[model samples]
Target: MDLRAGLSQQQSLKLSMTQELSQAIALLQYSAIELVDFLENKALENPLLHIKSRKAEVYQPKAKGQSQKSNDKAWIEQISDQRFTLADHLFPQIQDMKMSPFQKRVVTHYIYHLDDNGYFTGNLQDIANHFNFSLADAEECLAILQRVEPAGIGARTLRECLLLQLNRQEVKNELAERIVSEHFSMFAEKKWKQLSKLLSIDIKEIQQVFDYILTLNPKPGAAFHYERASYVIPDVMVVQEGDQFVVRLFDHILPKIQFNKDYFASLNSYQDKKVNDFLNEKQQDYHWIIRSLEQRQKTILNVTGKIVDKQQAYFEKGPTFLKPMTMKEISEELGIHESTVSRAVREKYVQTPFGTVELKSFFTNAIESVSDESLSSSKVKMAMEKLIKEENKQKPLSDLDIVQLLKENDGIVVSRRTVAKYRDQLGIPSSSKRKRYD
Candidate 1:
């Protein structure tokens, strides 16, 4: 055997994590909505950050004894001023429970350590070590807090969070409570048949319990603060200006931001090391905020531009002309990652002349039929809904019957199951539910 080695050809690209250029490229791929949010959050967390808005400029005139201009810069401030940390709420409850001061202190520390979702990310041992308390004592405090008004608060696991909530609810029977506590996994997975057999209950009864379970607040601490609210300030506003479409960001109420030049200028004269350091840090923060805002604007423009380019037909002809689209396709065309496209669409909405719509709603995967023509799942679903709406309620169509009608009458050759899925997606109640009385 020959001992000589052969070389193989390979090419690679290097990426730097710390460089702002790389970060900006990463931000570009983010949907306009995501980029704005990410930048706004960064600005809020950093004291040195500033945003320049036309609203701010108008406000300057008002400060000089003038009227408020409609085009004033809307300074994007923190959502809320009240600082309601989890520790503030939980520690008070622990104190009121008549626990020892040591236990209360331990509980306070634990609450501070919890994540936004109210889960203890750190292990119990690490928590105990941080406060010099035994693991058992730390756990006991956690247990008490878990049972508080927000039942899921301070839960270490999802199971515990759910069970705590279930305990507080008026279940009215042992069976419902047991099913929720012990068979939650089965219930969630929609293994209705299995649950019925295991619990020795009828299928309809099991389904009723399932419906009740679904109504519980999964994240009890979700509404703890205004900051945690799911808010999306649209990047692009598509309004009908006569016969054409116009696009702009909806930044009406945000504040205008600028550097405190007087403070910055004062920093130059100061000889104190700490003051200079603070000014320098603030200066860098200001730069990041300004750059992030600019990047957000550009990113939104780029995404909206692409969306308009690809979906021109839909804009002109309405939803029926919406082409098949996917995150992967958009990512490939834009030369970015799929996750970035997903993030851009996630929680981001577009205010069109027709109505306010989530950006992702414009994109739907197509299902090709035997005739070699492709139709969007959304379009198919719409067609199915139309058929159902026009169908005779006295003799409502079955899933298979709908499938045949779609193929023979509407030229959409989809399976019965596909019809069923589309029906469910459209929230078109089944034949049983749609039955009418004389």
Candidate 2:
């Protein structure tokens, strides 16, 4: 050990502040879909930065002898730009109408209550009471909003929404109208025989009505958004050339950024200490942006590569072959945190030979059966739905009956409450609501 003129020029290793910045970038890139939104907001706040629209050429990693061929495959691009909700679409139309500011506010409150499907979960009376408006006034506002572009925007229930649209069409089929208005539960629950008997209609006619109901849009407001507006650009590509799967990133379009040479050139011209320090600070910020972008790209590629390796069966076959996976699995595999894995897959979609699918859809939770072998919850829910479909319509299986059936037949001994949960997940109505005596 030698003590030199300086206290000892010993080399030491420590995590830099830039390492945290790298972690932040990794977190953002992993969940780019969600983080992209936050980034967009931040860009609005920061004068020096902006979020550029995703370009097609930027979708593949730059590698020697890689295919630069454009994909002819059509993808369902997410409409990311300003989407006009039911409120945005309907509020302006009501402006010229004979209504006071108080009445306008009441209508606006009801608009907020509407779900993505443009149907109000709260009752008209409740909305009116919340705003201290007359029940009649609330109903009037709701009626006007419902009449906007989306044929059924502010109805209290699914049945009311459909009937309102049907009424506007001048469709004179009384039986069809009655079925939609009164027997939607029976139809949805697949109680065909009960509906047929109750309406005194042939089973064939009831089947026709059932088919027609399926054609109606459940979420009409979603239709107003343009299909080609914006989309998710996959940070990685898994290519199957011959029998091997090679994973790489799309990096060609990402502009290789560095601290602006011109800005650095101008720095030496400034003699003032304050001006020099300010320029130096901005230079660091520029370096950070470049490094952050690089880290973001690398982390996305690494995580996506792991995902492709784990989901090989899904790539080889289709969605049915998608094994039950979780954020935990990816985190453990990559030696990262679970939250990190979650962020990486958020709003991210990958293009495959099968089709473009969201990254999150590949992961599913498993349900434990009586044999202790785990089954995908989606598979169990599907099985429950199938069982309900084949059940006797006149005596639709109750949740308790469903539990017994699962235990005896399917070897799945789930509790009645669990059965109810699965039933609800399947969008199946209860036996009491589903039953119809004729």
Candidate 3:
């Protein structure tokens, strides 16, 4: 109960993280590309470090009908003609339309405001103010822009986008137009029973109309973008080797870093203590970085190897077989801290037989089945998708029906609510929306 401060010798053991250790921990989280960039920068800064550049393997083209020069010429021509973009697509159409110069200017301004999805994201009032024109004039320009090939273009809301498309159809869908205009909230929420009562139409008919709505392009400008397809570079590759899967780190892709022996040897003969101390500090930093990088690689290999082992079924049978896994489970199995496992997998990609997938995607929450076996949420989602795809269109299954089907067929007993959650996750609508009238 004594509160007075007293001088006393105390003995205790505590762990403290050094700056080098902190840097090592941070390096573990960096992706393959990031690590390469980091090493390249470090090599430039440190005089004692040298990164060996990979020798470009000379391409030995096989004897074919066309020469390599001809192939190069054709590739150059192909790239030159591939500069078409959303703006390029719309500008020609704008040029063809017969309008006053002022009208054309207004239309062009509206076009500039259109988002990647072809929706007009800017305020009409803002456009009006910029042009020093009435809001009505801006609206008129937007209306004319909506008349472009993509009917949903220049729409502010999803309701407007659908209605615009429906209006432009040669044979208009009156039911879809009404649903989008009036019951958009209900349509979005998939309140099929309420919609049925409100429209006084059969649930089946509403679903048929919904199916038509699905056919219309939601993101009209997505395909017209000039953006090149991005490719993922996987840090690790998992190859099936007979009964076991082999996890190999892509070390060849990264530049090999080593100490410059000549530079290190020359630094030892320097007379200036300050300069020598600075060089020594740099050398120590270089050594720590190299060690950290090696440790990072080992941690990654161990974590990914364990992950591949746990998700072996996923590699063999596809995404449906993705078993329930967690960082804690992996940490316990690998004899590492949960945070260490997390950092090792963060922003990392692993190339499998199927495709390149993020390492973090391997860990998913478990859902208990009736058989007392755990199912990954991803697995349940796949099961839900399969059921929806194979269900009778004329009488689409409800969430409750899916719950029962999973229990009966897959031996997975999930709640109706859980089925609904999984269904939503798959971007699937309700039973009423999925039903086919004809």
**Each model's total of backbone clashes:** 12, 8, 0
Candidate 2, residues 18-124: lDDT per residue as tens digits?
A: 75466564546544455555546545544344446555542444468754552322122333456565567777876766777876776677777777677777788
Write model 3 residue lDDT over 1-438, tens digit each, in one string: 999998989899998998877888889998877887888888878888899877656554656786778767655543544666778889889889888899999888888888888989889898799889899988888888888877788899888988888998899888888998999999877787789998899977877887899898888887776666777878899998898889999776688887888987887778989888978898899889878888988999999989887887899989878889999999999899999998998888898998999999999998878787799988788888899899998789999899998889888878988888878888898887676666
Q: What shift in Å separates residue 192 of candidate 2 from its native position after superposition?
A: 16
Give, for candidate 1, the lowest lDDT window spanning 10 residues.
53-62
Instruction: Name the best candidate (by TM-score).
Output: 3
Residue 357 error, candidate 3, Å: 3.3
Whole-model lDDT per candidate: 0.70, 0.69, 0.85
TM-scores for all predictions: 0.53, 0.56, 0.85
Q: Give candidate 1 regions above 4 Å deviation.
A: 1-85, 129-134, 169-172, 228-313, 324-351, 355-374, 381-410, 414-438
**RMSD value for candidate 1:** 10.4
Q: For model 2, where is the 10-residue window of minimal lDDT?
A: 70-79
Encode model 1's per-residue lDDT on 269-355: one tens digit a residue: 989999888888878867865786676665565566677778777777788878778878877888867776775666567877566
Clashing pairs in 3: none
Which segments of model 3 are wrong by more than 4 Å?
1-5, 52-60, 63-81, 172-179, 187-208, 240-244, 261-269, 308-322, 365-375, 436-438
Could you give me the TM-score of model 2 versus the true structure?
0.56
